[model samples]
Target chain A: MTTKFTPDHEYIRVEGSTGIVGITPYAQEQLGDIVFVELPAVGKALKKGDEAAVVESVKAASEIYAPVTGTIVEVNSLLTNEPGLVNSDPEAAGWMFKIAISDASELDTLLDADGYAELTL
Target chain B: MAEVPTEDLKHTPLYERHVTAGGRIVPFGGYALPVQYPTGIMTEHKWTRDNAGLFDVSHMGPGFLTLNTPSGDAETDHAAIAAIIEPLICGDIAGLKPGQIRYTLLLNESGGALDDLMVARSKTPGTLFIVVNAGTKEGDFARIAAAAGNKATLKRADDNALLALQGPEAVNVMAALVPPAADLGFMQFGEFDWNGTPVTISRSGYTGEDGFEILAPAHMSVALWDELLTDPRVRPIGLGARDSLRLEAGLPLYGHDLDETVSPIEADLGFAVSKRRREAADFPGAQRILAERDGKLSRKRVGLLVEGAPAREGAEILDALGTAIGVVTSGGFAPSLGKAIALGFVSPEHTAIGTKLQVSVRGRSQPAEVVPTPFVPHRYFRKSV
Candidate 1:
């Protein structure tokens, strides 16, 4: 699996044509303790950078954008009752949704791990 | 969150300490203060409820109003000082016992609140200590100073660092640092010597916790802060937790829950309108304020227990039939309760406790119900007589 990130700090891990999307650890850290997460429903179509979900911390709310255009195949239901998972394990079990890639070429426009690391720094 | 360029923001004395401690600096009230430390708002908030939370509230306006000329008789001097300020607010400053603090509202000519503030009768017979909100300091000070005219002088002390050590263990920390200050009853304040420098400490705080607010010289502030943090029970809390704590405490923040256009009665702060001031009908906007008190008010502020996603500021409040009633002033997740809560104004008829309501978040209506606030009970320390 290859992981790519957006300048807004969302990460999409791709396995074949399917991609799992979630906010990066750095993004969660900046956002502080997660109190609530509002996710898009399954079967929803999203364009690149569309506001796909909302992550709320104790102080404020932030939007999580889609990394690339695709159709949402699944959403992390665990977040409904356990939002803190995003703060504790943002990259793994905290994954927000799964999207089926509609345009493979869009993945090439996302930043690589090295590029995202430099951007955060 | 929108970033305010650091170059344009003023730095508090604790700015460097916050940075060194891994605090996320943010612009608030025109100052560069920490929104949260590395431990985050939830941890800092819970730590405060369970232990002690040290906060830098220096951005607030703390000042003294002293009679320009005291006649040497304590009562006469106090009356003279109080007379100069009573016209500007709805609190009976003249009735305050020495060293006692009263929360009061600064009202405009129309009876709308200009700002809510704390006014204290200083032990020094001719002086009064006042603290106003940070965002409204400049205008508030100017107004107070102008109102004082030649009879009294409003001495601005915003340059001083104001620290609040709050929580259940706050008194214990103070007892160890300054023994005399710990004996103060809730809402009382006194000047004490901290080592060599003089410090004014009040047995009061915004958090619904037993705590103290200390006003100390800027140069000695860092040393005092370092000394306090040495206590294992004390942690440096940021503005993020401070906001949550006050929200749970059901306190109306100056700019959000309160504004220049909100009257004391409409804002659910009628208690701040002193009985003496009400009877005399001498405070600003007394005519309108008294009318509102007598059931002429249209809307009233109420607390809501929201289900599902947090309803943020500007969210619409709706009735059971899905008709809009009002707008939320302040809404967020209450760390102490583990649920979303909000403060909003709705038609007076719909404000009774347990009234079913709804809040539109992102165009979707969510279940909400009117509930008594101080979402968590206030644990202020009141000494038993």
Candidate 2:
């Protein structure tokens, strides 16, 4: 599985044509305690940079955008009850949704592990 | 988010302490203050509820309104000072016993709240210790000074550092640091010496917990802060936790839950209108205020239990039919309750406890219900009579 990241801190881990999405650990740290998470419907299609979800901290609400154009195949309903999972395990169990990649070429435009590391720096 | 120019913001005396403790600094009311420490707001909020939380609140305006010339008699001098300030607010200042504090509102001509403030009668006579919200301090001070004219003086004490130590263990912490403060009843204040420096200690705070608000010299702020943190029960909390704590307490924040256009009655602070002021019909906007009290009011502030996402300020409140009825002024996640809650103003007909309501959050209607507040019960230390 190869992972790609957006400058806005969203990450998409590709396994074949399916990609799992979530915020990076750095983004979760800056957002503080996650109190609520609003996810898109399972069948919703989102373009790159489209607001796909919302994460609310104790202080304010922040929008989470889609990293690449795709159709949402699944969403993490566990986030509704345990939003802190984003803060605790952002990459694995905290994955917000599973998307069916429509254009494989779009993944090439995202930052790779080394590129994302430098962008954060 | 745009970065607020730090150089332009005023720094409190404990600014260095906050930075050294790894606090996340933010601009609040034109002051550079910490929003949260490294431990985060959730932990700090829970700490304050369960133990003692030390907060730096020096940005608030604390001043003394004193009579220029005292009559030498306590009662006469107090009456003289009270008369000057009474015309501006709806509180029975003259009736306050020495060292007693009353929460009151500074009103505009049309009965809207200019600012909410604390006024206390001094034991020394002819002086009233007043504290106003930080954002409205400049205008509030100017207005009070103009009212005093040559008869009294308003000494601004915003330069001093103000600290709040709050929670169930607050009294125990004060008992160890300042023995006399432990005896103070809720809403009472007194002057005490801390390591030879005189400080004012009030047995009150915004958090729904037993606590004390201390006003000390700027130079002694660091030493005092370090001294308090030495106590295992005390933790340094930031403004983020402060806001959350007050919200859970059901207290109104001056700028958000109250403003120049909101009246005391509309803000659910009608209790601040003293009985004597209501009877005399003498305070500013008394006619409108009294009329509102008599059922001429249109909307009322109510607390709500939100079902889904937290309904932040400006979120629209809807009736059962999804018709707009009001707007939320303050809403967020309640750490103690582990659920979303909010304070908002809605038409009087829709404010009854248990009334079903909805909040439109980001174009989605979330289920909500009118509920009684102090979402967490207050644990004030009211001494038995």
Sort candidate 1 into its docking category. Answer: high
TM-score of each model, in listed order: 0.99, 0.98
Work out candidate 1's RMSD over C-alphas.
1.0
Clash-forming residue pairs, model 2: none
Instruction: Give the alpha-carbon lDDT of every model.
Output: 0.94, 0.95
By summed lDDT, the worst window of 10 consecutive residues in model 1 chain B runs over B1-10
> Compared with the true structure, what per-residue lDDT tens digits does model 2 show for residues B1-385?
3346798899999999999999988999999999999889899999999999999999999999999999999999999999999999999999999999999999999999999999999998999999999999999999999999999999999999999999999999999999999999999999999989999999999999999999999999899999999999999999989999999999999989998888899888989999999999998888888998988889999999999899999999999999999999999999999999999999999989999999999999999999998899999999853
What is the i-RMS of every prediction?
A: 1.0, 1.0
What are the chain B TM-scores of all models? Answer: 0.99, 0.99
DockQ for all models? 0.81, 0.77
- Top model number, lDDT: 2
Real contacts retained, model 1: 0.79
Model 2 lDDT, residue B288, Cα: 84
